[model samples]
Target: MSNRSHEVEYEQMLLSRHGLWQHKGGRGKDGPMERSAYILLSRIRVQGPMSIGELSDAFGLDASTLNRQTAAAMRSGLVERIPDPAGGMARKFQITDMGARMLDEKRDYFVQALDKVMADWSDDDIAHFASYLRRFNSDIERIEGRPWPRPGTDGP
Candidate 1:
């Protein structure tokens, strides 16, 4: 079968540019959290607390980058550093109550926006689209060997 690599690449770029992650509908004075902050907090929420080393491995990011991100998060009171629950040497970053609240608000806003956008789509079509996107993301995660933790599943 022929590959539609170019088509997929262009469409993916467009989607990224127009995606919910970039939406500007935050409900508070501070506006939405930065993309990095959102993703980091989301990961922590899904997978529990994470140390710097674990975050680095999970995201394939460097220590310096994670340090900056986590530091910013701490300053904003979105996360806190605590002794590892497992009694490990490195401290873990845990999302704060405020962080969870903000994340939930942002997520709810995004869902509302998506609902409006997909108002005309059938339930079956939405399910199919979600399935395809999950498959695509799973394939990417498999290739990278860095599976993400899903809410209802063991992993990925």
Candidate 2:
């Protein structure tokens, strides 16, 4: 591996060891959504309804995997399948009202947790860190050809 690759690998390993991404279930109205559900709902929330094919293209995942994830989300009342508004043959998934509320709650919880973790960091430092993260993610997305949508812009 190159020098930068080695450094990135070490940092990523340390981040994993920190256990910050571990699921903290059992909270909110539905006991907190799963990570997959949270991400899938977030995409739908931002981009409106999306068919399975669209999701597969966006996430670079196969239909079977998306099927399972969407099924679980539907069972959890987080998303529902509706006919494509554009008259397409395949149905699209849309976030439900409950899903929206739960997404908001879950997002708030995550923001609060991050704020607590960064309590000692200065505002400028945090901003710089955020900028770096966005750049990093955007570069990866560019390489993968699967850019994500973001608020206040056409896409992330």
Task: Compare the candidates by TM-score and give the number of the best one.
Answer: 1
**For each predicted model, how many residue pairs clash, with residues at least 3 apart or on different chains?**
0, 0
- Residues 33-147, candidate 1, lDDT per residue (tens digit)? 8878889999999999899999999998999999999999999888999999999999999999999988888878788988998999999999999999989988998999999
Model 2 C-alpha lDDT versus the unseen true structure: 0.87
Which residue pairs does candidate 2 place in steric collision? Answer: none
Error of 1 at 27 (Å): 5.9
**CA deviation > 4 Å runs, candidate 1:** 1-3, 19-23, 30-32
Each prediction's TM-score versus the true structure: 0.92, 0.91
lDDT by residue for model 2 (1-156), tens: 799999998997887686544646225777657888889999998898999999999889999999999999999899999999999899999999999999998888778878999999999999999998888888999999999887777754
